[model samples]
Target: MPVYRPSEGCIHIDALSCLRNTGITIYNSAEPRRDSLEVSVRTSRPSCQLIERIESILYSVFQVCWLEPEQTAGKVKPFFYTQGQAVLNRSFFPCADTPSVKITYSATIKVPHGLVAVMSASQWHEPSADGEFRFTMDKPIPSYLIALAIGDLESAEIGPRCDILIMPPSFPFGGMENPCLTFVTPCLLAGDHSLVDVLIHEISHSWFGNLVTNADWGEFWLNEGFTMYAQRRITTMIFGHAYMCLEAATGRALLRQHIDTTGEEHPLNKLRVKIEPGVDPDDTYNETPYEKGFCFVSYLAHLVGDQKRFDDFLKAYVEKFKFQSVVAEDMLNFYLGYFPELKQQDVANKPGLEFEHWLNVPGWPRFLPDLSPGDELMKPANDLANLWSSPEVDLEKVKQIDISLWKTYQTVYFLDRLLEKSPLPSGNMVLLEKTYPKVSKTKNSELRLRWTQIIGKQKYTLPIYRALWASSETARKLALSTFQDTKKQLHINVQNYVSKILM
Candidate 1:
């Protein structure tokens, strides 16, 4: 197909081939005297190969698949979706795949009568009566963020200006940020709303990542770090400061794990990294960008004396960079320009607070947020854990501590501490389980995962197997790690069940 850019005096010939999905070449042509130019070329649909497929079904990157029937046990129905990160969007259309290019798009999609088609644009909750759906995104976004999904879908309101899009069971990612339509896995329907944090994370991306994007993949922390910080802010608003801190602590742990595994010298550990030509951007993907970026942003907030001042600055930053792509230097320059005091050489020279040191230097940042507030809120849970860990402490006194007022995060913190030690004696495990039966029965995914970890370490085969089978896809790696270690102790039938579920 010929895509003519009369203004640029160029025509792009996009072609479909057997080996490669699509390829394009731009040729200089005489500028059109009229407002538009038209050209005709042989056109064929590109059959994009799936970058990765899970469960002998669901395809990642860009492709179509079939989802198992919702009501029928063995029946399957066609479900089409697109994941266009990196250069995958070019498979759909010939366009600049880099994040630096942003565009506003409008599309009209037609599907079967009963099916609904949605895109990362202004969309209707319900499909049109004629089965024709039209969408427009006034805000400019990179091509990778331009996604489409069509299926037997349903929606329900979660909050003001927020609704959940329930995709087929074959949906792999726990959730994807596709503007108004945030596609989520069916596993989130765990009875309890513990998985809604994923929703908050996606919503925050609307502002931090979608509105103000990183110029390229190398500055990915710009997209992730800001969104994570915003997600925490929203979580704190809804669930209180203590819950937010607990989540932040969990993220910090993940960041440290990535640093250790990937090594402190890895370029990906730095807040701002450089991507060499011909290198795939996905290789550098890790929690370092999300968590480490968050730490640096959080450090800046604290450095400016208070979160409110930092928050005001964030509002201004978003306003300044809305609908635009930026690099780390753009953000740093904005920070210095916004706060004249920060521009002083003396202020910039402070250890760990320097712009270049924080953004360019590898390893963990010298500055870390003081989580003393979280420690204070979690003192009760910590005290209970300490009592249980003490050799001379009375178990009865520990059992008597009132934990009814404790949040889910407090319970998770207590359980996490328990896992840090070697497995407890069987009798102690029994007593602990009996005292806090809710830990085993609770539907909260976070607490359940932590409780399962403790149980798995103690070699409590039954609970470990159950947790493995019930775990969310997002936690599959963690669940599998626990299962691998304890699988030998479990019954053959239980082992088979876990293998089937995870697979």
Candidate 2:
């Protein structure tokens, strides 16, 4: 959509895409690239056509419990998921869709008698008896953050001020960060509570992205990176530091793999990237901003020699910039202002400590978060994996190891390490499934994902196929990858069965 300044007037639109009798007079401002327009019509009705595009604000119905026909008695419950990002918000209403503009908004929506509606604003858990819901956001947020969903929804409290919005079992992504109500996939209700980290990540956005904002799409990391770091901190508070470190290490590995695939010099890998004209901001989306940004911020905290000091700095930065948008340089300058000594020649001279190169250069930085805390916990898993790889190790002794002492993440680390090495013998594989019955039965999606990969790679067709069929409707990325890998190695009948199930 073209950028234009609106005068103190309102124009009625019958349609958005096509302008039939609509006429507007342009009043060019003296300032370059800044113009104002005025439009008025005396007709009893005025309208504009709806603009059609490949992707825009979407309003569609999805069926829940479709796979469980017997349990649900072939009943189809419909729900809606709205995706309004980039310029899609403009398709729904008149507004600039860029991150440069922030606005406070209010909405009142009327839904079906039995359905509820939610938005990215302060919300009431219960709708009015008449099925009308009202919301207001006091904090100014960019248009992309504006969201809406309507359905037969339920809510559960997870924290003091945080509540999880339970959607139909078939909803895709692990979760979506709407302001007050966070939408989560039904698979998370697997009962293990392992997927609660998804909720933590979304909760952290309240401070990192919602209160302190990014100036533009190019500095998108400011929103996500800070949120990732804060999410880890919250995770640490809830699940101990070892759990936090394990998650960070997992993210680091992902970042490295992304860098390897995208190339070290790729612009998308940079902490601060420039978007060429006509390029969709969504095209540049990846884990770089989330993980790399966390790495840089974590590295800075470690460099300062005190995590508390870094925490204090973050608080100060947010206090100063709350409700305002900023660029990457603004964040760097804030750090310099907070810790004036960092700008000194001696400090700046330190290797890999240069701010400019760290922010602008693409690829992994010279330093990463100290994963030693997690690596120490992983040592037992690593040693066990090594023993399993050797021919002389007795399978009986391998099964005797006290894996019950290990946490879910440690077990995952051990399993992942084993997968990286030579394939385990069939006997050892059988022993593994029997030894840690919980790993096979666990509802933790992360652990299940890693274990499923091992099962797929070992060509353990039956279990892998069963895992796929049982988990297929959840729509997890790792689950999808496992489905593809296992399908390749299974019998034709099994493959056909999986194909039908997935479809």
Candidate 3:
């Protein structure tokens, strides 16, 4: 009998076992199989005494018994974590790539004598004499969850359980890192540690996603939506409720911009969208599952009418379904069962706003969280924004409010409001630059990105957004010349985006 981790499908479970063990590992999951020249193979592992025979019962899958690995060389090099979005892990490993099944993986990765290796796993053993690092992930996670990186890495204690691994933006391979070492943009390091929210985001996933999970791509919101909700709950506690609301207000702007761009009817906007065969599930990703799903979850809290009670339900929900893959209905069923009174009242079947409608609906979220709590913070930014965006003059009022005094998100929210109200009288540009030099000079990526966007978009009418050079004649020549001098320093993505604006 072959040792297999339990997965929903027969192919997934069997193929997974044959893919990772010492005895007859499956490899080369790419290129389709050639016409079946009759072949039979039995895999065995000594400890488990696991054996399996896969016969001619086959679809097309190229399974290489001897693994082929990608190689690279460097005197002093870094290999950042690898995770192809969605289920593209097969490009690097021959493992079965499906979220429907979670796999537990253990690997002994060899590196240069002095280098370090890390995998996004629970346990790590010190490097052995032979320069091999061992890692074990007892948790069953979707294939994409496994990540590995080997480098001359160093670590610092960030928290009791958290360790900081810094990689400069110049690290070419540091595209996107997750898991054990959790790689992130260098920009998030504001020196003051104020912008490490992405770390909080990944940590939240430990419960809502890594623990319990979505069964398929269609229900990905269960992972991200819940994570977003969880992330804010944490922020609300660490910061005040007002700050959380202020920060969320910025997120709402992003969600709205995304919806407008994608056209609300796009299928990806649905909380549970269909993933057609052959289309990569990663391609279906958007803000819908995140912001819209957060709204839905937040609505549930609203229905309960007690923040404490809703939080208790969330805790109970995690307890009920940890370590399982489930669809939207599973969550709904569990929710209704947990709150019998709400179930009796038929809250889900409410008119014009049924839970089913929320799951299937497109466009704007039916319910928006009351962000008024942030108004205490938002009113200042809004007032500042109106002053800059206003046709008449109020430059004096804008100068009175210190931009530096505002927190990072407060600054971010102010800029986002400006973007929403772009095409200000060109005169406002002078006042803005003169009043808030930080907008042009700040090192904060979030603020810098927003400022650049305002410069890029302030003049172009909506749907025909263009760069600062296109409309702001005062900033045009200088912005273009600045690009000529510094564009090469920008990342390729930034270069292309800025290039588009200048064009």
Candidate number with the higher lDDT (1 or 2): 1
C-alpha root-mean-square deviation, each candidate: 9.5, 8.4, 7.7
Give TM per candidate. Answer: 0.75, 0.76, 0.79
The sequence of per-residue lDDT tens digits that candidate 2 reaches over residues 143-172 is: 767877776655555567775676554343
Judging by lDDT against the true structure, name the best candidate.
Answer: 3
- lDDT string, candidate 3, 1-503, tens digits: 34444673333224444444444543322432211122233445433234344431223312211111221223245344454446656655645566667788888888777678777778889889889999998878777677776666677665666444554453322223344656565667766566866777777877777778888777889888998899899999998899999987887887898899889898888998887755558655668888898999999888889989889989988889877888889888988898899999999999977999999988898889998999988999988888888888676686788777878899889888888899678788777787778667888877777886776663112112344455557767766787788554444445566777777
TM-score for candidate 2, residues paired by index: 0.76
Instruction: Candidate 1: give the clashing pairs.
Output: none
28 in model 1: Cα distance from truth in Å?
20
Candidate 2 yields a Cα-based lDDT of 0.67
At residue 111, candidate 3 shows an lDDT of: 79
Superior by TM-score: candidate 2 or candidate 3: 3
For model 3, the local distance difference test gives: 0.70
Candidate 1 per-residue lDDT over residues 1-503, each given as its tens digit? 34456786774332223124454332222222211123333435434333322112111232233333532122344567776665556555545677888888888778986677888886554457889888888878888888887776655555777655766544545577777767776657767576677888988888887889888888889988999999999888998787888878777776776788789998878887777765667655678788889888887787688788899999999999998999988887888788888777556668657778888888986777766668766777778888776655576778677776676566767777777663764467777778778777776656766776776552234446555557666456777787788554333445666777667
- Residue 386 local lDDT, model 2: 88
